[model samples]
Target: MSTLDQDLASQIERLRAEGCEIIRSEKVSGASRDGRGELEIVLQFLRSGDELVVARLDRLGRDTRDVLNIIHECESRGAFVTVLDPHVTTRGEMGHVILTVLGMVAQMERRFIKERQKDGIERAKASGRYLGGKRRIDRHVVRELLAQGQSVAAAARTLGCSRMQIYRIIGEAPPAV
Candidate 1:
């Protein structure tokens, strides 16, 4: 089995140990070119006919639209998702309402955080106090490793950044024109 398959199998095994009945599953690689190789595996697990079990809502989706779509899909299929850590369980009418409200709040929080970060960045730029983040790992070294047939995962581990960062750096090089 491939690494991805193994990882998913482990996740299913863990969920089953916790008494969840996983009906279906989809292994979603994270969005964006840079985020490739970052797995966001999703499973539709259930405890009973009316109760769906999820380790976390973020495991369901990252964005509000995606989360709502998943929730609606489960509801249409007569299933309600419950998160373990937050202790949020959605069973019926109240469940739907609570999920909707929580989705709205989470979206709002994301927007607010983005705005605040943008404001801080702008302020720091005006004051000339922000030098941006630490310099990224050398792209020349990255290219050397890739040319030597080293995998992105190995390169990322050596460079001390995520696989996503390695992809991003590789993507930014000037294309032959």
Candidate 2:
């Protein structure tokens, strides 16, 4: 069998050995996307003894707040969460503590990434090499559209952009001939 099949078979084997019955197994389809189908299944079907199993904690959420909220919501409904790869789960007191620490680390990591990105942008600007982001709507096109009596909102809609972009283009465009 394939690696995924083998892994799933083993998980089923382990869960069954631990006296747990498998009711349904589902796949979450996207990275950092809401697992709508998986969540609906859990909230709709899980009983008091049921465990919501995932391959990893990140599968449950993109950050600490999201993960904690998911855990709280599951627990409030009398269901527990089980993460398999490292065996961290919401099934015990110690698991909660570990999960909390891991979640905090994830949140801090995200903050650090954003700060690094901002620092990089500032350095680029200081070096006189930063020319802002690529223009979404061409200023010439915006000016032509405006000269043709198009409204700012209409120009934004035509350009698949926002009013802010239209306003910026207006500020940059030279006087009409």
Candidate 3:
């Protein structure tokens, strides 16, 4: 098995020891940095009296507001969130408060990451290492496509992009796609 599978196995073991039963597991392939998996599994699948388990609280979200919203949604449905690492469960007032603080810290950490990325980008731009990113699709090509009797939506599809992107490249407002 892959290392990721092994780690997940260990986390599941810990949760199982806490009297938690696994119903379904989803391995989200998307960046899922936005808690899509958590939302889909916890909000959509689980019912009242169900518990959503995660290896870590941060795994649920990257922002404090998002984390709180998810927890609130679960609580409203009578479902609880259980974290395995530090073994915190949102079944109590104290745990909810602690998770709130941790969520804020996670949000702060995310802000720091974005700030550091922006600084690095600025440095790279100054050193000419970045050229504002290259456009794989050309504006002239979009105009040409439009000139060829193609609709804005068609041009966007041909370019493997969105109509808004095509409109931006073509420098004009587009009809609804």
Best by TM-score: 3
Which residue runs of candidate 3 sit more than 4 Å off their true CA positions?
Answer: 1-41, 134-136, 172-177
Residue 54 CA error for candidate 2 (Å)? 5.1
Best by lDDT: 3
* Model 3 poorest 10 in a row by lDDT: 26-35
Clashing pairs in 3: none
Q: In candidate 1, which residue pairs clash?
A: none
Candidate 1 segments whose C-alpha is farther than 4 A from its true place: 1-41, 44-51, 54-59, 76-78, 84-87, 139-177
lDDT of 1 at 99: 68
**Model 1 C-alpha lDDT per residue in residues 12-68, reported as the tens digit of each score:** 776677787543455653222123222222323322355656555555554667677
Estimate every model's Cα lDDT from 0 to 1.
0.66, 0.75, 0.77
TM-score of each: 0.52, 0.60, 0.72
Per-residue CA lDDT of model 2 for 44-125, tens digit only, reads 7767866787665655664787788878878988989887757888888999998888777767777788899999999999
Candidate 2 lDDT score relative to the true structure: 0.75
- Residue-level lDDT for 148 in candidate 2: 98
* Model 2 CA deviation exceeding 4 Å by range: 1-63, 171-177
Higher TM-score: candidate 1 or 3? 3
